[model samples]
Target: MTFRIGSGYDVHALVHDVSRKLILGGVTVPFDKVLRGHSDADVLVHSVCDAILGAAGLGDIGRHFPDSDPLYKDISSLILLKRCANILNEAGYAIENIDTTVFAQAPKLEPYKDEMSHKIASTIEISPESVNVKATTTEGLGFEGRGEGIAAHAVVLIRKISKKSG
Candidate 1:
């Protein structure tokens, strides 16, 4: 079986806007600040989508879902993820496993990691056990450490599906 691995990273600044909700991994976590982006700005989902697309030989998320497009304005990152899965399927690829990590300094994410993994797996039509979600702090060394922004990294393993002989 042909296998490919890809990694992706993404970050978004946090803004003090009560009108915006803090969504991470498709789950809304109550926080004073929300990520500023054209979409819901779910860093975890964005990173995962990029990783999958990269592994499948497709372009990055920005190429497929441009921020300049009004159609993606305030769109849910989960929706983008679903489209990525479809793109991979069309390219004759199947996801094997995915690992991801979220970097932040506030609003602890341990409580939501499992849910995040499950949500991502469901969105990609993969087994929950195939996805792993983790979170960490920067120990006060960067934008994420300073709570000014949130970032996430994702790595995915995908394989080409072989056709069955008649």
Candidate 2:
């Protein structure tokens, strides 16, 4: 079997909406504003999805699921992640591990890191130990530090299926 590594990065602007929900790692977060996007705007999950797709040598999420498509309007990112997993399976690849980092200046995220890792692992059908989630501040150096948006980066490793599995 062979191994491949891929990395992905994503960012979304934060918008004001008292009622909009902040969903990350499939967990709801209490916040004053939520990300603005055609989908549910889970930056973390989106990056992870892209990493898996890249590792499998597939095109990006935009090519596979365009925001212009009405079917994906307001869709949850978890659903998108699941579809990416299916694509990997069809390509005879399985996730070996994933590492992710989120950038945000406000609303300390350390408390939720573990749950985030678990959610990502469950979506990819990998063990929690195979996934790592971290949060950091840009030290007021970028848009993320300015609190204009949230960004996520993910690196993933995938293993090709053996001949027997194929």
Candidate 3:
């Protein structure tokens, strides 16, 4: 019956000479080097998943999906996000909305914002308006500024499912 908000942030190191693919809101983006990780290394989805889990008091993405497990090797973050949604549902939490931001220095993302929003919303069964994805750069400052890697931040609001019917 109450509303709660949670924020999640994640960063991954960019390995040199590796392919880069930024996956935001379940949509894959084109870039020179992809994020390096045990899974697909989608920084955007990872942050979103963590936010939902944090809001629902379900730990974090790493706890639910361990990198040590070979089963998750190169796994699609979309799949991980689906699992996170199930966890929230099982805990009687209804998603209200989610806003996400991606930090990158190359391959402007403005062109793909719509597709990213639609994909993430559909994957979580939420209205497209409920999910928002934005992209920005550090203006050439730190690791992200140097294009060493990509990072994402997400804030999610959830409401407890009421026992009484409407």
Per-residue lDDT of candidate 3, residues 11-125 (tens digit): 9877643554556566777666667888888888899899999997889999999999999998888999889988888888989999999998866889988898888888889
The root-mean-square deviation over C-alpha atoms between each candidate and the true structure, in angstroms, is: 2.3, 1.9, 2.8
Q: lDDT tens digits, residues 1-166, model 1?
A: 8999989899999999887899999999989999999999999999999999999779999999999999999999999999999988888889999999999999899999999999999998899999999999999989998999999999999999965233
Q: What tens-digit string does per-residue lDDT give for candidate 2 at 4-69?
A: 998889999988976568777766777887888888989999998899999978988898999999
Q: Rank the candidates by TM-score, best first.
A: 1, 2, 3
RMSD of 3: 2.8
**Which parts of model 1 have CA positions greater than 4 angstroms off?**
163-166
TM-score of each: 0.96, 0.95, 0.92
lDDT of 3: 0.86
Cα lDDT listed for each candidate: 0.94, 0.87, 0.86
Best by lDDT: 1
| Winner by TM-score between candidate 3 and candidate 1 | 1
